[model samples]
Structure formats: structure tokens, C-alpha cells
Target: MPKSRKRKATVPAAPPPPRRPRPRMEYRARSDEAWYGARVVVQDGWLRVMFENSTEDADEWYNPGADFASLGDVEALRARFRRECPPLDHARCGDVRPGDKLCLACDIHGDVEELKYYDAVLETVERAAHGVEQCACRFTVRWTEGPRSGCLDKVGIEVVCCVPKSPIQDPVLSEFLDDLTKRFAEDQGTATAASQQADPTPMSEEELCGVLLSLKRAPNSSTGKP
Candidate 1:
């Protein structure tokens, strides 16, 4: 018999390495800006929240303590933001609708809370545009699952000044803006008069002093306290 050709042993391909599970956190919540809003991030045995601001530069990040009291506080915290921050004018000025899922800017009316990391002004406003009833506008935040975190103490933070999201009037700021506009107009008028009919000399020291004193003494009728 002719030499039989030796059959070559076939080598099996090496088994692929096992895939590692991805470490990821899903953040979902109501926000005024794209990322600057109340959000909850769920991760390995932990739930993290940042509601003070919706931006990367938020005043604080609330790591809801790993307990019942902290978990219970979520609802109340959302309620407070809804009560204080003005809702974005989605119907008229913004892209959001009643059901559309997207973040809208908030109308922060007053100072932020120093200790609680919430808005200082808790009272809601009654918008005249709607007439009679208080503004239905509010910041809404919702999330699933219980909370867990390794943090020990609540964070104390100060947030940046909030710009209005729409034309909604803020009781504290509306009058102030009106006065600001008036002051600007007056200043422009003075400059125009000086350029057109008077000498180009800068304001004298005495005139500056008089203006400062007048501003200091000017009675503000807007705040009833004054």
C-alpha cells in the first residue's frame, strides 16, 4: 500500500475572553438646563441626586443618605423646588409641551437656602397672566427605586444667580428690573444732553457725591418695609 498521507490534526480556535459588565449610572430627573436640573443617578448600590442646580457647576450635589429619612425627603425636596423656582414658559417661549420630555430653565426668584440647599423663597406666586389662581408652573422631579449612598452629612451650598426663563413676573425682581430700565434711560438721557448741549467735562466730585447721597436716601416704595 502506498504511504498513506498523515492526516494533519486540526487545532481548535481559542475561546473568546468573557466580557466585563459595564459600570454605568443612569441619571434621570427634571431640569431647567440640559444637565442642570434635579437628577437621580442610580449605580452600584447607590442613588445620587443633585437638585440645587442643573448645571455641572451646580451649587451642591445631594447624596441622599443611605436611610429612610433621606429617602423620604426626596418628595419634600421636589415640592420645595416646585414651590420656589418658576417653570419655563414652554407653551409660548420654550420648546416643551405638557407631555414633551425635555429640560427647561427655571426662574429662580430669590436667594438660595444656605443650610438646606434649597431656595430661600418658598411661597408660590400668583401670575396675573393666568388670573386668580396661583401660578401652576412648577419644577417636577420623579425617580424610581429606593435611595442608597455612603455620604454622611448633607451638603451646604450657594448657587449662582438665576436668570428668568420666560416673561413670568417675579414680585421681587419685576419692580427692580423696571427701576433698572428707568435708571438706564435716565443715564442715557443725561449723556445725550451733555454731548449735544453742554461741555464734555467729566462729572465733578461734588456732583458725584450728590448723586450717591440721593441714591442712598431715595425712598423705595416697592418694598412695603421701606
Candidate 2:
């Protein structure tokens, strides 16, 4: 009689690996940006990121210990850029409508808490995290399941990546903010000269000296005090 052929076992395709976790801070910042103008109703364990209607239709849940920055953060960042550079306009306003791609950003930081060991080391060897666990040990041991290792103390971070605002700044938003700043000498010279020529009143020496002193005291201020 002919020998019976043995059936071969078909191997299954491996499932795709899970995605890397984002840092905690990063998660906060994104949540903040996404619900910028939304009527965020934070209650219980979840947060509701809402639309202008203040209804529950559009919302997202956020857990505790997460950071969520509103549009205010973008404005603050822009303000800093403007102050430092002075040549650009760094103010961001709600003038930007929905669907418009405006500048955005966030920040995150993480620190691992507990150590994880191999499934089989006591599969006793303590976990040596390398991106993802990718090794098998020589010996076998009873394995207590520990948290899967990587960096568990995730921090999701974000920052204003980019934005489009004032028409005057259409040319360069990524460029140094000072680039959009008004060239004082070029911009105000004509007006100053014309005003000086047509002026009906000229101040006395003491008055002029006082004005100079006030200007010197608050050089950075938009208006002189004292």
C-alpha cells in the first residue's frame, strides 16, 4: 500500500504591532488646541470638547493630570515672538475661521515608573526595554504579567506648528516675527514730517525735555507713562 502523505500546518500572518504611545504633555496640548473655542465641559472622569452650540454632539474625553492649552497659548507664544523679534506681527486672534490652517503646537514629557520583566525570565530576568521587547530568554520560569515595557510615563507635547493671520503678514509667517514688524523709520517718517511742518503748536523747552524724559523711562511701552 502507498504511504499516506502528512498534511502541513498553514502558518498564520503576524498581526501588525501596536503604535508608539505619545508623551502625556503632548496629549494635553493637542486636546487644548482641538477644543480651542469649544465649550469644554469637564465633568466626572471625562471632558467634553464641544462646539459653539455648547451641545454634546462634538466632544472628546480627557483624563486627569493632562494639560490642555487653549488658543490663548498660541497668542502668548506669538506675543513672545513679536517682543523678541519686533519686526513681525505675532498676535493671533479668533479672526481665523474654522477649517483654516492656523499655527499650532504643544509640549510633553515622560518618566518610566515600574520595571517589567520577561514573560518566561523568573522569565525572571528584569525587563531591558529596547524600543519594544524583541528577545527570547534561554531558560523558562513562571511569569507574572507586568505592564508591557516601553516608556509608560508618556507626556504628549504640542506647539503652534504654523498659522495664517493678518493680511499684512501674508508674506512670511514662519520667518522671524520681526520680519513683519513695521519699519518705524520708513513707516512713520512721512507722517511725522508732515505733522511737524503743519503743526499749529510748538512746545517750550521744558515741555520738550519732560516728553523726552517720559519716552526714555518707558522705551518698550506702547505709550509713555510719567
Tell me the spans in candidate 1 whose CA falls farther than 4 Å from its real position.
1-101, 104-166, 198-226
lDDT of each: 0.32, 0.29
When summed lDDT is taken over every stretch of 10 residues in candidate 1, the lowest stretch is 152-161
Clashes per model (N, Cα, C within 3 A) = 5, 34
Residue 159, candidate 2: Cα error in Å is 15
Q: How does model 1 fare in lDDT?
A: 0.32
Candidate 1 residue pairs in backbone clash:
32-104, 35-54, 36-54, 36-55, 37-54
Write model 2 residue lDDT over 1-226, tens digit each, in one string: 1111111124655633423221111111132222122223346634443332223533454443343243343343233221111111223221222233322211122212211111111222222223222322111133222233222221111111223233322112223223223333344677788888898577899999999998777756655543
Per-model TM-score versus the true fold: 0.21, 0.18
Q: Pick the candidate with the highest lDDT.
A: 1
Task: Put down candidate 1 lDDT per residue, 1-226, tens digits, no spaces.
Answer: 1111111135655633423222121122333212222333444434444443223343333333433243234443333222223333423322222223222222233322211112222122222233333234342322111121121121111121122333433332234334444655676788799887765778999999999998878778797443
